[model samples]
Target: MTYIWTGKRWAYLAMVIDLYARKPVGWATSLSPNSELTSNALKMAYESRGRPEGVMFHSDQGSHYTSHK
Candidate 1:
Protein backbone atom coordinates (compact mmCIF):
# COMPACT_ATOMS: atom_id res chain seq x y z
CA MET A 1 0.00 0.00 0.00
CA THR A 2 1.19 3.54 -0.80
CA TYR A 3 -0.55 5.26 2.07
CA ILE A 4 -1.68 8.08 -0.17
CA TRP A 5 -3.30 10.61 2.09
CA THR A 6 -6.12 11.60 -0.20
CA GLY A 7 -7.17 14.48 1.99
CA LYS A 8 -9.34 12.11 4.00
CA ARG A 9 -7.71 8.72 4.34
CA TRP A 10 -4.97 6.35 3.30
CA ALA A 11 -5.04 4.55 -0.02
CA TYR A 12 -3.96 1.37 -1.72
CA LEU A 13 -1.89 0.36 -4.72
CA ALA A 14 -2.29 -1.97 -7.65
CA MET A 15 0.82 -3.61 -9.04
CA VAL A 16 1.90 -5.23 -12.28
CA ILE A 17 4.48 -7.98 -12.51
CA ASP A 18 6.35 -9.74 -15.25
CA LEU A 19 6.27 -13.49 -15.02
CA TYR A 20 9.41 -13.71 -17.15
CA ALA A 21 11.77 -13.44 -14.17
CA ARG A 22 9.37 -13.32 -11.25
CA LYS A 23 9.86 -9.63 -10.60
CA PRO A 24 7.85 -6.46 -10.63
CA VAL A 25 9.15 -4.46 -13.53
CA GLY A 26 6.50 -1.86 -12.87
CA TRP A 27 3.99 -0.76 -10.28
CA ALA A 28 1.73 2.12 -9.35
CA THR A 29 0.27 3.48 -6.12
CA SER A 30 -2.95 5.40 -6.31
CA LEU A 31 -6.24 6.14 -4.64
CA SER A 32 -7.44 3.73 -7.26
CA PRO A 33 -5.98 2.26 -10.40
CA ASN A 34 -6.93 3.14 -13.93
CA SER A 35 -5.49 2.45 -17.36
CA GLU A 36 -2.89 5.16 -16.88
CA LEU A 37 -1.37 3.47 -13.85
CA THR A 38 -1.16 0.16 -15.62
CA SER A 39 0.40 1.79 -18.63
CA ASN A 40 2.99 3.54 -16.49
CA ALA A 41 3.97 0.24 -14.95
CA LEU A 42 4.31 -1.27 -18.39
CA LYS A 43 6.42 1.63 -19.53
CA MET A 44 8.64 1.36 -16.50
CA ALA A 45 9.05 -2.34 -17.05
CA TYR A 46 10.04 -1.80 -20.63
CA GLU A 47 12.51 0.89 -19.76
CA SER A 48 13.97 -0.81 -16.71
CA ARG A 49 14.24 -4.24 -18.22
CA GLY A 50 15.20 -3.13 -21.68
CA ARG A 51 12.25 -3.83 -23.92
CA PRO A 52 12.91 -7.02 -25.78
CA GLU A 53 12.21 -6.62 -29.42
CA GLY A 54 9.69 -9.45 -29.65
CA VAL A 55 9.19 -10.70 -26.15
CA MET A 56 5.70 -11.89 -25.40
CA PHE A 57 3.79 -10.21 -22.62
CA HIS A 58 0.83 -11.84 -21.00
CA SER A 59 -1.85 -10.64 -18.63
CA ASP A 60 -5.27 -11.68 -17.43
CA GLN A 61 -8.55 -10.13 -18.59
CA GLY A 62 -7.54 -6.72 -17.36
CA SER A 63 -9.05 -4.03 -19.55
CA HIS A 64 -6.03 -1.81 -19.13
CA TYR A 65 -3.88 -3.88 -21.45
CA THR A 66 -6.77 -4.81 -23.67
CA SER A 67 -8.09 -1.29 -24.15
CA HIS A 68 -5.12 -0.47 -26.45
CA LYS A 69 -5.51 3.21 -25.72
Candidate 2:
Protein backbone atom coordinates (compact mmCIF):
# COMPACT_ATOMS: atom_id res chain seq x y z
CA MET A 1 0.00 0.00 0.00
CA THR A 2 1.11 3.54 -0.58
CA TYR A 3 0.05 6.74 1.09
CA ILE A 4 1.19 10.20 0.35
CA TRP A 5 0.55 13.48 2.02
CA THR A 6 -3.12 14.08 1.39
CA GLY A 7 -3.21 17.77 2.06
CA LYS A 8 -1.01 20.73 2.88
CA ARG A 9 2.49 19.33 2.75
CA TRP A 10 1.83 15.62 2.44
CA ALA A 11 1.07 15.16 6.06
CA TYR A 12 -1.14 12.09 5.68
CA LEU A 13 -0.61 8.45 4.79
CA ALA A 14 -2.21 5.70 2.82
CA MET A 15 -2.21 2.04 3.68
CA VAL A 16 -1.48 -0.73 1.24
CA ILE A 17 -3.15 -4.06 1.65
CA ASP A 18 -2.26 -7.53 0.41
CA LEU A 19 -5.19 -9.29 -1.20
CA TYR A 20 -3.78 -12.76 -0.96
CA ALA A 21 -3.17 -12.58 2.74
CA ARG A 22 -5.93 -10.04 3.35
CA LYS A 23 -3.51 -8.17 5.48
CA PRO A 24 -2.09 -4.71 5.77
CA VAL A 25 1.37 -4.98 4.29
CA GLY A 26 3.13 -1.69 3.82
CA TRP A 27 2.45 2.04 4.04
CA ALA A 28 4.17 5.06 2.59
CA THR A 29 4.04 8.76 3.32
CA SER A 30 6.04 11.90 2.81
CA LEU A 31 5.85 15.62 3.13
CA SER A 32 5.84 15.77 -0.64
CA PRO A 33 4.31 12.63 -1.97
CA ASN A 34 5.46 11.52 -5.37
CA SER A 35 6.28 8.42 -7.35
CA GLU A 36 8.97 7.53 -4.89
CA LEU A 37 6.42 7.76 -2.10
CA THR A 38 4.49 4.84 -3.44
CA SER A 39 7.66 3.22 -4.62
CA ASN A 40 8.91 2.99 -1.11
CA ALA A 41 5.72 1.25 -0.07
CA LEU A 42 6.15 -1.28 -2.80
CA LYS A 43 9.71 -1.81 -1.79
CA MET A 44 8.66 -2.31 1.77
CA ALA A 45 6.15 -4.93 0.72
CA TYR A 46 8.82 -6.94 -1.00
CA GLU A 47 11.43 -6.58 1.68
CA SER A 48 9.08 -7.62 4.44
CA ARG A 49 7.43 -10.41 2.54
CA GLY A 50 10.47 -11.43 0.52
CA ARG A 51 10.56 -10.99 -3.20
CA PRO A 52 7.50 -12.45 -4.82
CA GLU A 53 7.82 -14.43 -7.99
CA GLY A 54 4.52 -13.25 -9.52
CA VAL A 55 2.90 -10.90 -7.13
CA MET A 56 -0.20 -9.08 -8.29
CA PHE A 57 -0.91 -5.64 -6.86
CA HIS A 58 -4.27 -3.92 -7.00
CA SER A 59 -5.42 -0.43 -6.19
CA ASP A 60 -8.18 2.02 -6.82
CA GLN A 61 -7.92 4.58 -9.60
CA GLY A 62 -5.81 7.22 -7.94
CA SER A 63 -3.36 9.60 -9.50
CA HIS A 64 -0.38 8.17 -7.70
CA TYR A 65 -1.44 4.66 -8.56
CA THR A 66 -2.12 5.41 -12.20
CA SER A 67 0.13 8.20 -13.28
CA HIS A 68 3.09 6.99 -15.26
CA LYS A 69 4.73 10.31 -15.65
Candidate 3:
Protein backbone atom coordinates (compact mmCIF):
# COMPACT_ATOMS: atom_id res chain seq x y z
CA MET A 1 0.00 0.00 0.00
CA THR A 2 1.10 3.56 -0.71
CA TYR A 3 -0.23 7.10 -0.53
CA ILE A 4 -0.24 9.99 -2.94
CA TRP A 5 -0.64 13.66 -2.28
CA THR A 6 -3.57 14.83 -4.36
CA GLY A 7 -2.71 18.49 -3.70
CA LYS A 8 -5.38 18.51 -1.00
CA ARG A 9 -6.21 15.16 0.58
CA TRP A 10 -4.29 11.89 0.53
CA ALA A 11 -5.21 9.05 -1.75
CA TYR A 12 -4.29 5.44 -1.11
CA LEU A 13 -3.49 2.85 -3.72
CA ALA A 14 -3.42 -0.93 -3.54
CA MET A 15 -1.98 -3.21 -6.17
CA VAL A 16 -1.66 -6.92 -6.86
CA ILE A 17 1.33 -7.97 -8.90
CA ASP A 18 1.80 -11.18 -10.81
CA LEU A 19 5.10 -12.66 -9.79
CA TYR A 20 5.56 -14.39 -13.11
CA ALA A 21 4.98 -11.25 -15.14
CA ARG A 22 6.66 -9.00 -12.62
CA LYS A 23 3.98 -6.41 -13.23
CA PRO A 24 0.70 -5.28 -11.78
CA VAL A 25 -2.30 -7.33 -12.74
CA GLY A 26 -4.80 -5.44 -10.64
CA TRP A 27 -4.91 -2.13 -8.80
CA ALA A 28 -7.33 0.12 -6.94
CA THR A 29 -7.26 3.55 -5.36
CA SER A 30 -9.35 5.06 -2.62
CA LEU A 31 -9.45 7.98 -0.24
CA SER A 32 -9.38 5.61 2.72
CA PRO A 33 -6.77 2.98 3.41
CA ASN A 34 -9.01 0.13 4.50
CA SER A 35 -9.94 -3.45 3.80
CA GLU A 36 -12.28 -2.44 1.03
CA LEU A 37 -9.42 -0.89 -0.88
CA THR A 38 -7.34 -4.04 -0.70
CA SER A 39 -10.35 -6.22 -1.35
CA ASN A 40 -11.15 -4.33 -4.51
CA ALA A 41 -7.67 -4.85 -5.88
CA LEU A 42 -7.70 -8.55 -5.02
CA LYS A 43 -11.14 -8.98 -6.50
CA MET A 44 -10.08 -7.38 -9.74
CA ALA A 45 -7.00 -9.58 -9.95
CA TYR A 46 -8.99 -12.71 -9.23
CA GLU A 47 -11.63 -12.01 -11.83
CA SER A 48 -9.20 -10.77 -14.44
CA ARG A 49 -7.09 -13.86 -13.99
CA GLY A 50 -10.11 -16.10 -14.69
CA ARG A 51 -10.51 -17.02 -11.03
CA PRO A 52 -7.94 -19.75 -11.09
CA GLU A 53 -7.93 -22.50 -8.54
CA GLY A 54 -5.24 -23.47 -6.03
CA VAL A 55 -3.69 -20.05 -5.97
CA MET A 56 -1.84 -18.82 -2.92
CA PHE A 57 -1.61 -15.20 -1.85
CA HIS A 58 0.99 -13.59 0.38
CA SER A 59 0.85 -10.23 2.02
CA ASP A 60 2.78 -8.08 4.45
CA GLN A 61 0.04 -8.79 7.02
CA GLY A 62 -1.04 -5.21 7.14
CA SER A 63 -4.26 -4.44 9.00
CA HIS A 64 -6.15 -3.82 5.82
CA TYR A 65 -5.08 -7.19 4.43
CA THR A 66 -5.89 -9.01 7.64
CA SER A 67 -9.20 -7.28 8.29
CA HIS A 68 -12.35 -9.38 8.47
CA LYS A 69 -14.16 -6.96 6.25
Extract clashing residue pairs from model 3: none
Give the TM-score (vs. native) of candidate 2. 0.68
Q: What's the CA error at residue 23 for candidate 2, in Å?
A: 1.7
Provide backbone clash counts, one per model.
0, 3, 0
Overall lDDT per candidate, in order of appearance: 0.68, 0.70, 0.95
Best-first order by TM-score: 3, 2, 1
User: How many collisions between residues are there in candidate 2?
Assistant: 3
Model 1, 37-68: lDDT tens digits are 66776777778877768867777767766776
**What TM-score would each prediction reach against the true structure?**
0.68, 0.68, 0.95
Candidate 2, 3: how far from true, in Å? Answer: 7.6
The alpha-carbon deviation from the true structure for residue 33 of candidate 3, after best TM-score superposition, in angstroms, is 0.5
TM-score of 1: 0.68
lDDT by residue for model 3 (1-69), tens: 999999999999999999987989889999999999999999999998999999988899999999998
Q: Rank the candidates by lDDT, best first.
A: 3, 2, 1
